[model samples]
Target: MAYSADGTRLFSCGTSKDGESYIVEWNESEGAVKRTYQGFHKRSLGVVQFDTTKNRYLAAGDDFSIKFWDMDNVQLLTAIDGDGGLQASPRIRFNKEGSLLAVSGNENVIKVMANSDGLRLLHTFENVSSESSKPAINSLAAAAAATSAAADRSANVVSIQAMNGDARNMVDVKPVITEESNDKSKIWKLTEVSEPSQCRSLRLPENLRVAKISRLIFTNSGNAILALASNAIHLLWKWQRNERNATGKATASLPPQQWQPASGILMTNDAAENNPEEAVPCFALSKNDSYVMSASGGKISLFNMMTFKTMATFMPPPPAATFLAFHPQDNNIIAIGMDDSTIQIYNVRVDEVKSKLKGHSKRITGLAFSNVLNVLVSSGADAQLCVWNTDGWEKQRSKVLPLPQGRPNTAPSDTRVQFHQDQAHFLVVHETQLAIYETTKLECMKQWPVRESSAPITHATFSCDSQLVYASFMDATICVFSSANLRLRCRVNPSAYLPASLSNSNVHPLVIAAHPQEPNMFAVGLSDGGVHIFEPVESEGKWGVAPPAENGSANGAVATPSVGASASEQPQR
Candidate 1:
């Protein structure tokens, strides 16, 4: 079941005992069926979702096809039957703004469709699971064969030479004969290996053949999609908008047949469990959409999104990685804060631990790497903050920032550390207050008290020019501050821009990412899985705020002072 953007309608799909599947729309408040779109799928219906963007359509999938329905009129808008056969209920997810829809199931392929172009197939990813497995399997086979042959030949020749006089001379003669015999046996082995192929066929493992997609999620920026399958997590990107058809309508055209594996992380233990019903392992994407993270059996793995390379694997004692941070300037360096009260500085290029920092006695809660100051800071539950110099990968300073007056025994909440983009200062945000520190002296410059609220501040980032800072409170409000004096510039509530149905929901902001190049532009991800891109509009020396646009675009019009425009102006998203 899925709720509409405004929460007024609910879309659901289910199969009856007789194998008939149906999709229905319900009026949430009245508890009545608004519309019933029946007999759309021949087999059991497995997936149903509502497109919350301007498209306002409902997509359902079954064994044979995927169907899209207009939410307002209950009309069958389009049905796509070219998906071949979905092994299980197809998993469908929309991009942050609902412009692109990604569908995957038992098959090893993910189909990306464009909503603006009548749900046309924009890109297809094939062999998402087997691409990496193939090479690993072949290498394992070659290594095993080499080891077995070497061991067997060594034993056989030793026995043969042992029975003769002067065993050393016999051993030398055995090699000459074995060399000749090897040449003859090579052809026999090749022919023997191929003989069965002429009469029989090779079959793939059942699990590999039916590796179904268990989870699908889009990054906050809508630049990539994370598909969690049975044995691995697949990162997919390279999205191209659909071309306009002859009728002047955007439609799916044949996309370039070229598709590359963005990156794949192996879940060896999870796959070895061999349970088809088990859930996919837990994984996360970094706030900036630059790194992919996954944890299994107390080990954390990081992958570079751009190159699709495994950046590093960290095995910290006792506690696992609870927080991660990538260096803004040097992608090769990453800081991982573990629950064990230690921070691991990893050099991704060599896949080695550059340093292990220890200062706090309890778990580490937050980590931040400053590009301008070349410093790494970590916060811990032990009421301590540790600062490290990135140049030497050594701890430079440590400060005991204890919990507030009465909350000393409470479990430490997440600590947000951010550096101003202009390299002037940095901020450390704790439970109910934040402190600004000068970059040069690393001295506390000013301390600002955060408004008391049930929801804490989930994210805080400085603007590019270092003039303004934006902090997102879980209460669905973003507080802007003047960087110099930490003065409250304004507080903007994102709920006002959300649909009416979602206003009542606890749709609080989870993350806020500022653009690296554009100071006025930033992105906010909500707890309800929605990403909003905002850009402060500059007009007549005043900042004009505009309504949030689909796909984060401003639509070429700006409103009066409020916040910013949309993600359309930022290059990263």
Candidate 2:
């Protein structure tokens, strides 16, 4: 059973009717049956969820197959038939972007389906249990304890415990005794570690572990196909990338895909380093992408991106750093946004906070600096955009964001800023709208109302050359506009592209990074943890003949695997 996105409706699977499983939707506030979805299942349904972004649809999976119901039409949209690896109902999940749907029942396998093209099958992957984790004491934990011990007092023996996922099996750990100490509890050195003590390990059933992929990401290059399972990032060759689509067609000749041994990354942050309750990892990359910064409820760590070796660790006191950014001109100068509504200017060169700027009444959501403008602009969930004079870190001015055009009654939130290449003009996003602002005037030069057509607007940015503006909605819709006039040049949705098969996908682009060299080229991050390269395809100009305008003018783009994709990954332009 689950509540609707707005929390006003509740849906649940109940007894079968006429030998078919049925779903009842209840008015959340009054607990009354508002509607029922029927005629889809013959078995007991295990899971039910709503995807209201693009389709007013509710998805449910039973023992034999998974089904979808269009709540808007009160009709069955699609019924996918399969055992779904289940003796019972399968778990169902939709990616936040609402384009990808995952269903799993009993085994390690999961089926991924795309909602864009009549619920076509895109891929299937192995699912692993994230619930169960083994705790092995690390040298980093001993070192962490040693730093505090040495600062307080010198002791021959130190007691430590294995730090696991909040279970904290307290084992009285003594360092290894090289030459037998007078007391057995006394230690010589913390050279090796042991597993947690006196705790029963429980393994979850394979069926229970079914459900979802926790995250998505890119691998070493576009050539590799990576799969994530049980905290491991596996470079899978059997279930390959750009190799074969699930197609949902069965062939008797093909051998079953076999699992292979996989590689993993070292623990980036030890459990001992941060408060588990508040240990949310925050990450930022330096301007050159040479260094990586991470903070997880504790000290901030600056590490080498390639080697993943810790270069430095410094504590940013109380309230924690919610967001981090590097100075455009000086990477060493870090802008740390605090949870308690403050921004600290930390200078790595001198190893001290340069200044603390306070103006926002809430945590900072975005941070951008302009050495050319000699100022820094910050936006916060408190609906405040504050400017700070970088010279002395003085608050210059503050502005409360305006509510959306039709949402005057509801206060707006989630403001962000991005300075144009010139550093004179910047993009400001607040609520369901984006505007251009200049440093001196602080006036909205141009503004456009971003609609919640797909899902709520998630992100927006200016082109590399600052000629185009890009805004992405959560439901896989990307819009491009001319910054000069705010005219919509192109709008790309699930049905936007040619080669009909490619237009509908299981993933939608949410996060984007503009290419450093190409003004019309950028990499868009998909909700499924993959990346797609978007670049403008231009026709050869001997007499100035442009590509078809329907393909989105000269700035029109096609999506493909980025960072050196092979021939197959490159789509036909």
CA RMSD of each candidate after superposition: 29.3, 29.7
How far out, in Å, is residue 34 in model 2?
A: 72
- Tens digits of per-residue lDDT for model 1 on 1-573? 455554345565544434565677765434355788844556554333323333366766655555666666556665554335443556666665554555663436554444323122121111232244454344433333433343345432221111111222101011112333223322221011112111111111122221333333344343333444435544242333334322221111211111234343333322223332432233556544566776432456676666666766656334565566766445556677776777877776787888888787876766766544567777776656777887777788777764445565556666656666434467777655667776556677766654333456666777655666777775666666666665454555544445567656777665665544345555555555444555333331212222232243233332223222111111111
Candidate 1 at 223: error in angstroms?
Answer: 6.9
Off by over 4 Å in 1: 1-298, 304-318, 326-331, 370-374, 391-393, 439-441, 453-455, 536-573
Top candidate when judged by TM-score against the true structure: 2
**Against the unseen true structure, what C-alpha lDDT does each candidate score?**
0.50, 0.49
TM-score result, candidate 1: 0.45
